[model samples]
Target chain A: MSQTRDELCWMTISEAAPLIKRRELSPVELTQAHLDRADAVDDRVKAFVTRIDDKAMAAARAAESEIASGHYRGPLHGIPVSLKDFYDTAGVRTTAMSKIFADRVPDEDCTVAASLKGAGTVLLGKVSMSEFGLRGHPTSLFSIPNNPWNLNRSCGQSSSGSAASLAAGVSMGSFGSDSGGSLRNPAHSVGIVGLKPTFGRVSRYGVIPCSHSMDTTGPMARSVADIAALLQATAGHDPHDPYSSKEPVPDYSANLNDGIKGLRIGVPRDYFFNKDGGADPETLDLAEQAIDVLEGLGAQVKEVTIPSVADVRASQGVIMISEAFAYHRQFLRDRHDEYGPVKFRFMLGALYTAEDYLQAQLLRSRICREVAEVFEQVDIIATPSMPRPASVQGDMGHPFSSLGGLNFLVVFNATGHPAISVPCGFTGEGMPVGLQLAARPFQEAALLTAANAYQQSTDWHTKHPVL
Target chain B: MAEHPLPSHDELDARLKGAGIQLSNEELEFFRGAYPEFLDQLKLLYSYDVTGEAYPFDVALFQEPQ
Candidate 1:
């Protein structure tokens, strides 16, 4: 067995699981390896907000004992994973990165966290995030997690720590929630795979709310297969979650290697790509190259117009701001100083008039209908994940700073579609670029299938940031 | 590309005050100047015809059966 640190640290969950199942690698050994790696890299990266070493080691020992006693839980059985701070862990601090709830410890684990533990995974710790998962940058009042690729660059997120931790090899996989590009943006910036599953696919019960309607918790990993494995372990209907759907959860890993031949992929040239001065040239180039790869794999690619994506963004923003304000109104009013400036001012200042909020919801229905029509023609839509490459913290403005009055990822959030960001290429400075894919609501299986096909055809996702 | 009318700075400031969001004079001016563009951009949502369908904004509290 290779005893090299890089070999052990960089192995994907898919690779690690089989080894653990074969008894070739004990759960205790794997858990210790990651804890040691975290100790080495975490200070610089600040990926984890809370380190639960003793609890994790105990769980690993239990897993080892169970496997030895001929009781195997599943694929996740010894896999080390991290949870975003927004996830509620019973008896553990689940601060949403805001001082208002800094001492708040839930009495029950979030559905996703409980599900992963039930599947026998060991939780490494809670990853850092934006304040209340409210903003997109690392300027939260709490300790901001630095991007691993460039210590000074913004990791692009509410899931800032999840991306950083995965890039730093602190965990094989992690959980992240997306309201507006929270998952995709960081994944794009940090060069990892992040999925925003269909809104009701993963139970959000116990996860802190950002936008009640748009928040989705999903897996972030280094590879498509690893994400699929984590997704399989995390997704299912839970009765406690009012919005949880009884929709069947498919076996994501079994069909991942299915080729993209004969699949119809639509390129929304006008809305996503050809919009005036929208995406940077390198991003556009990478996306076009990804499309070429899909075409090469026997996918029928066609240019389709997605009417009024800008309108979708606006409506989504209104709903997001209004809903967020409603959720945090008391906190904002009572604990005003506890919130970060950007999120505080933005949330408080943007409380939409009842008329504006209602109109936004009505408009959301229209945008969703329009997108639904587009999905009827294409099995999935592909575009650049972000308009540009990751920028150094000072070089770039605030993460939520608008680019010509548009929020790139909010449109899909408004439509409640399942979207993902997969690393497609790198910029001149070696920063990662991402290609985004969106499928109609509840079509995550198709989206993952297509993404898996793309992963097999290219080495893009294989490239990791050299920390 | 269609032209849309937006509320002026004074109108926006007055509206903010009416809405009970207390802002300092400087903050009021700043937001007033910012409002026209913000309103213009937000008006873009009116371009789409989403009138009757249910908006997808429901929240989930727990993952167990209620």
Candidate 2:
């Protein structure tokens, strides 16, 4: 590996970990390289909200000393990473990019933050998110981060800064929340790999709540291997979160090169590829090409359907807003003026009847059952992460304008399944398109295995935005 | 089924206030513009007419990992 600073900033964690572990590369040097690159390029992306430059350097130096003493913690030891602003870091301000919580700081780290720190990763500080992770709000309190690939286009939210930072090479890994496509949408928009692990696989102990039932925390990185390494560090049960699953954690990075031979990959054409629900022709073509790549890897492919996709989309919206309102009702009542335009989103929840909320939950249950039936037949399901490329600012039409719009990504949130968006191909405009794969609950290993196999066969994940 | 009449602006406003939310005229206008689509989605969810016991939990909630 070359020793250039620019190259060091972009090296995936999988590549940097072994060298850092063997004492061939200095953790301080690697962290400093990324911090310098972030200083140079983050102005264009506005990816970070509070960069703890001194703290990051201090932690990197400590990691270096530990490794030099032959105490390498793991793959993440000395690795630089960013947290989406929603995750609480003790003694650090953890605003969700909203003025409402602008002065808020926590006394404890979130479970995932603690897990990463315990794994010896260096924190690069908090990144921006949509106002309280609600979409359709004016980003008045924070800078609207630009897509590294095309600054003029919107880096889809609410994990906008997380994906933007990774694509810009400001951070090697990032963790973002996804209630309704927050992680995967931006990953699709920015051409990175985003994983939304099974709902309970990772704890949300201290992260700001968006939709309790739907919200999940997961990793976004440049490749499947990097995502696996990051997940290996942060995933597992924490007793603090009531919703956290007790499932045993597995080593996500151990089977990356196992290949997808004899695996079953399902493609649901009615909802994901049809003219009514699929993305534009070019985007769909790219997704189809990704499927072909999977087929070329000796995987058996077939068509399948998870029923009531439209109903799931509608129910997810209702439940998400209602749950969010449940959390923010007091703030909206007292400090309405302090909120960004997202107050409109929170207020809409007030209109839903208690029955409406229950009905949405019932529909969610039905959708989960439907998806489970599909998973019984297919090991993994693949679809276009988004029906279109990155939409320009102020031009995001209604969510219904395209097939793969937010609907395709939100279904998994409703079903509580694990899903990931891997860069499949780029449009003629050079915008990235993502092929999303989802598996049964706790089947993230299968999902990652298939995605890693596909990524191994394609070069799309290697293409970075020329920032 | 009987027609589920949509709420009037006054009714919506009262409901919001009942929930401890009062919007200014501008914010009221923003809510007015955004709430209809949300209402339509609620209607879509009700369109399915799901019956029997409705467990309002995610798939992982009740079941242990396999």
Best by DockQ: 2
Steric clashes per prediction? 9, 2
Interface RMSD for each candidate model? 5.0, 3.4
Model 1 lDDT tens row, A1-467: 54566667788888888888888878888888899989888898888988899999999999999998988888899888899999999988999887777888899999999999999999999999877776644344457777887888878768989999898888989999998889999999998999998888899999999888788899999998888888898788888887777777788888788888888898887766754766687788888899999899999999887676756767777777778877776665455555665443354334357667777888777667677777789998998898887767645444334523545677788877889999998888788888999987677878988998988888877776666
Model 2 DockQ reads 0.57
Per-model lDDT = 0.79, 0.85
What is residue A378's positional error in candidate 1, in angstroms? 1.4
> What are the fnat scores of the candidates, in the order listed?
0.34, 0.68
TM-score for each model: 0.92, 0.96
lDDT at position A77, candidate 2:
96
Among incorrect, acceptable, medium and high, the docking class of model 2 is medium
Weakest lDDT window of 10 consecutive positions for candidate 2 chain B: B56-65
